[model samples]
Target: MSDRQAYSGMAVTGIDAKGRAAIPAFLRAALDRNGAESRVIIAESANAPCLIGFDPAYLEANRAKYGSRADARLDAGETVDANAARLAFALNDIASYDSSGRFVLPPFPAMKAGLDKTGPVLFAGLGDTFEIWNPELLEADAKVHPAFKERALFCLSQWKKGGKG
Candidate 1:
């Protein structure tokens, strides 16, 4: 329910010959600052044609928020934690970073984004989460999705409206 720290601006890196893609140092630094270097979850969502990376902090935050919501409607006799667990596991297929700082992408994401044992991938900074996209796909998505423009305009309008006007 609260705003997460804004972490943006990153460059690209290639997956090594051995399929190890180094996450951006800046991004990694951000995660480290947030105490999220130990583990990270990589998954894919349809909204973006890229691999989505989530830190434990963000995931745990989400889990807690959803858990609280679930708790509000728990059966008096039944366990309140059950609903929380169910909601938490809904997006549980998260991949974690290895000792060498790499988490393999899920099959669906790897195939969809065409990420395999060769070439580079774009790692974008998305504040609370990070996205790994194929360069082509990232470009294509940018053209079609007006989210950035819309968000900019929305922010400008909000500023003009005097913070709540």
Candidate 2:
């Protein structure tokens, strides 16, 4: 990915002694430009056993995109987009990056995101946001559907090779 982009490329990083994972240097710089300094909004991914990280600006945008009716809908005892509500709730946890460009993953959220502090973790960038995943979990799921795995990986490869995707 180019230096001018939002976030892209991928890596396998290790969680440190303090349950911290370093955001890739390139991504960090991008985050800075995008108005996220030492802090970021992290949440359990809606459709994956992983953690999703993005700038607070995106969170605000998300709230607006989903419209101002979310709260009203919930108050009416209606079934709203649960995932969006989940994402909205996740905004309560604002994560901070250390001097070394790492962010601590609280134990509860880490466990929920499928990390057990014993294996390499995958970092996948998806433009507006990025994800941290247990590599084995992602790999195992990839095996469940041939087309899904192939298409996803092919797109990832292209993005890593400098395509916009």
Q: Whose lDDT is greatest here?
A: 2
- Report residue 165 deviation for candidate 1 (angstroms): 40
* Candidate 2 ranges beyond 4 A from true positions: 1-4, 67-87, 90-92, 143-165
Query: Over the stretch 15-91, how does candidate 2's per-residue lDDT look in tens digits?
Result: 76678878777678767887787897778776877888887777777778676687678788987877766657644
**What is the lDDT for 42 in model 2?**
77
* Superposed model 1: Cα runs more than 4 Å off: 1-5, 73-103, 142-165
lDDT for each residue of candidate 1 in 1-165, tens digit (9 for 90 to 100): 254454575455667665567666677766666667556666665476677776767877877887677666564444565654653555445565665566555665577667875665667677778777666565556553566434434433453554420
lDDT of each: 0.63, 0.71
